[model samples]
Target: MSTKILICIDFSPLTPRIVKTGKELAKALNLGVHLVHAQPEKPSAPTAVVHQGADPSLGREMMKEIKELNNLKSDFEEEDIPCSYATPRGKTSDVIAAEAAKVEAPYIVLGSHGNGAMYHLVVGSVAEGVMKKLDTPVILVPAQQRLDREAGR
Candidate 1:
């Protein structure tokens, strides 16, 4: 029985390294990856109106996620890893924690910067926010290290 893993993806530039690390780890453990994104939230009263009509906003969020998911899948499809994507709307941290709990994933993964636009998660040490709250182990990619590795600094 392979373990299930969830990674919070935001499709930012830092995503490639995060995906690479995640794929490597998942392959090592024979685990499947659940790529998740917490969609940007608009106020309920206003957005709900846009959602109520035939123009339901469900597709709006999921559509972009689906494309990004395919990109992630293709990125490692040659490696024979099983990967999928999902999006559930809610507060950022709450959504990630809830999704991880729902899947009972043995590990939860996220990039240095999650949905929080305030600051870098590890740089500002906000990665602890998820790691501390999540029962499952959380893997945070130190993307800043990439610059150092590239520049040979």
Candidate 2:
């Protein structure tokens, strides 16, 4: 089986940078890419009323994320890198780590905006949470640092 890298993406302005970084690493490491988006769980949201045996709201949300995943996967494909995508719903870190483990990923890549470090002290950061949960190597590219690196490249 081919080894893969799990890339956790949020639909942030830093997404392109994250994808570029992941692609570069995957190329260097000779591993395929597995892109995963962890949709934050909304505990307060009520279940959508069943209409014709379908939850319209849930379907809309899934469609949105799947579209984003396809777009991201296309980027990897353009680089000639084998890639797959998934959008899992739940606690961001848990979902990401679980997906990584399921795919037997050897590495995980993600972007972090340390601007929220203070807030994370109260609520916890997805990056930090993932670090705590998984034994796999994680590469966290801080958003600001990524901007600098991209500019220099």
Candidate 3:
């Protein structure tokens, strides 16, 4: 059995709910938590026009993501839960599955945006992709439930 639960963080509105679910599961299972943020790969440019130096804006964006991840880690630490994080550049589902495998996590936690079938068919869903790739258990938090409850629907 693995000692930690790997939680996928996309910084979406559903992120907090996903984190909350991860925390609950971690506590129940007496496990640590590892958070992963899949940073999208940057587009390639032709060598002729490529700038020699790294883009300043891209650096700033990375720093911001690091700060957010650190903040989430601190939250878990404050509650006496072991916490760690990683931000890897790649396809979202691939990064998530790779991280889970790397950590040997017992469970993977993430959110479903609850998009309709048309949207999913056109753009694909990360949750679906990750499930297809990993044998590890996944706890998927449904974003639509939270929205509906908040609206008293």
Error of 2 at 117 (Å): 3.9
Local error of candidate 2 at residue 123 (angstroms): 1.0
Query: What number of backbone clashes does candidate 1 have, counting pairs of residues 3 or more apart or in separate chains?
Result: 0
Candidate 2 lDDT tens digits, 1-153: 457899888878887878888999999988899999876675312443433444566667667878888887887888888999887779888998888888889889998876555797788887778889998989887787656876896
TM-score of each: 0.70, 0.80, 0.85
Please identify model 1 stretches exceeding 4 Å from their true place. 43-62, 74-78, 114-126, 145-152
Please report the candidate that would top TM-score against the real structure.
3
Candidate 1 lDDT by residue in tens digits, 65-153: 67878888776566777776676767677777777777778988777743344555434443566666776888888676655876899
Select the stronger candidate by TM-score from 1 and 2. 2
Candidate 2's C-alpha lDDT? 0.81
lDDT of 3: 0.87
**Which whole-number lDDT from 0 to 100 does residue 60 have in model 3?**
66
Kindly report which residue stretches of model 3 are placed more than 4 angstroms away from their true locations once superposed.
43-55, 144-152
Q: Which residue pairs does candidate 1 place in steric collision? A: none
Q: What value does the lDDT take at residue 90 in candidate 2?
A: 94
Model 2 earns a TM-score of: 0.80
Q: Give me the runs in candidate 2 sitting further than 4 Å from their true place.
A: 43-47, 51-61, 145-153
lDDT-best of 1 and 2: 2
